[model samples]
Target: MHTAEELLKLQPVVMKQLQMIFEKDRVGHAYIFEGGKGTGTEEMMLFFVQLLLCENPKNNVPCGTCRSCQRIKSGNHPNFHQVYPEGQFIKVDAIEKLLNEMSKTGLEAGRKIYVIHSAERLNVKSANTLLKFLEEPEGIVTAIFVTQNINAILPTIRSRCQHIKFREIQRDVMVKTLVDSGITQSMAATVSMMTSDLEEAFSLAKDDAFALSRKTVLKLVEATFKNVHEAMLVVHEDWLPLFKEREQVEMALDLLLFAFRDIVAVKANPEAMCTYPDLVPTWKDAALHTTFNKLSAQLQAILNARKQLQSNMNKTLMMEQLMLNLQEGKSFV
Candidate 1:
């Protein structure tokens, strides 16, 4: 439950714009919050709504202790409505029903706020219906459309709303956030690159499967240079069982690539960033044994394996071949 100020820290410009709107008493009825998944658009929307509904708001900040704020945080406020896609798309019926609800007067003496999650999920018919509602702005009604793909939304809908874009969190900020949350610096750096969502990165850091997969990948990397047979055995017995899904496999490959890059980084400059900083001794040893050419070849092999995986290649076979190539220190080129 992030306060409006905390969520605004991620998007200072958007917060400034919102403050200007609120201070001028010119808050619009329709707004399009364009951002990637986990980019805090939903948080910003909720915060804005709280400001609008809070009885004791000051400088566009909601009093978290207020009844309206509490209800909004718990998602039980009478004037606050949310619409989600039924399956693949937001059906027309959902929009029609929402419009019907919005037609009524406010039950809480504040703005009637409706949030549409994944607005692009609305089908053509539903989108057209929403367009009609946006065209005729009702009394004290605010509609927030949140979507990752702004281009997928209808042009007419886009034209009717005030657009606010949320940018991806910066890597340094994300790393610090994860580190502050008790994740190791090495894992924080790796997970930050894997996801733009701070919460998802934190969740991945705490996931047992992700932790095991990372350990197994690092172990396989060490075994590849020390004993190829041991590396192959680990992939078959440990890595494969834990990472059967395509997404998991890809993530493991990404970890392997990062490991090789770390070796190169160590060789180039001892002070360079290392993804596996906790395994600096191991990386330093690998750097001492392997030349830049060998490390580059290994990286190329892992990248090639990634492309093959996307082509629906057999997972076990791909891993085995990748392990062999990495052990052989040979270039796919």
Candidate 2:
């Protein structure tokens, strides 16, 4: 039960939004929470849901002792429904059920809220059904649709809902929270620069999984220019970690991207840049030139592969191919 301020950084503007909703009581039935992926938009939506469903709710928070709050905390809240992707997208059938539920008088009255997380994944038929509910929503039905990209959503659905922008909760805010929660100052700073990505922040703070994976990435990279058995051992040690978190997967990809960038930098100026900057002296000028073009294509391939992940593709195969592409241009010395 972290404070929204701690979780979402308690930015003045976003706080003002809650105040505005409470003051005027004009909060729309449907709200579109939009922001960068991995920025805790889902967490923010959950917090808001808690506040609304809490029985003895104060200005912006729910009194945890209340019956409503207890049910929500216990995952037994009757009125509050959370719908999300089943596999890769929310189908039309799922949307229909919610629409039918909302069309009723009110399951429990005061406010019946539905959190449709990642609404962007909703298909065409599903979206149209949602639009109908938006057109003439029942008295107390409140729907919150979340997405990383609003432009990709149907314009009809977009127009009906109140769009709430969830921005990058400032790195300073995220860093301070992490430090308060027992993370060290140096590690907090490192994760923040990597992006206000929540998964990355968590991975950086909890070293057991992520640090091991990073060690694997480094070993594999260094092995191509040094030792093979050691690299494979490193990869096996943290292989399970990669399957655990999407942020870790993304971070691993970032490492590959960084390696590609290093190759580019080496090509552009051999002495100026290297993937593992400390290892610049170990690299030969001829070697950097040899893999230069291959690095460029690999970078593009990684980007293309990242996009492919958004679709209903096979994750294991996609990631395997991606890792293979990453190792393509370089030779094991």
Sequence-dependent TM-score of model 1: 0.86
Point out where model 1 deviates above 4 Å.
106-110, 227-230, 233-247, 310-320
lDDT of 1 at 93: 96
- Specify the highest-TM-score model's number: 1
RMSD of each: 2.8, 8.4
10 residues in a row with least lDDT, candidate 1: 1-10
- After best superposition, candidate 2 residue 139: deviation in angstroms? 1.8
Question: lDDT values of the candidates?
Answer: 0.85, 0.67
Q: Which candidate is the best by lDDT?
A: 1
Tens-place lDDT digits, model 1, residues 1-333: 676656766777888888788879998989999989778888888888888888898877888889998898888988989999999999999999988877876466657889999898888899888886777766678889999988998887778888999989878778887887799898898788778898899999888878888899888887887777898898888888888888888898998899999899999999876777788888898789888988888999999999999999999888888888887888554
Candidate 2 yields a Cα-based lDDT of 0.67
Clashing pairs in 1: none
Worst 10 residues of 2 by lDDT: 324-333
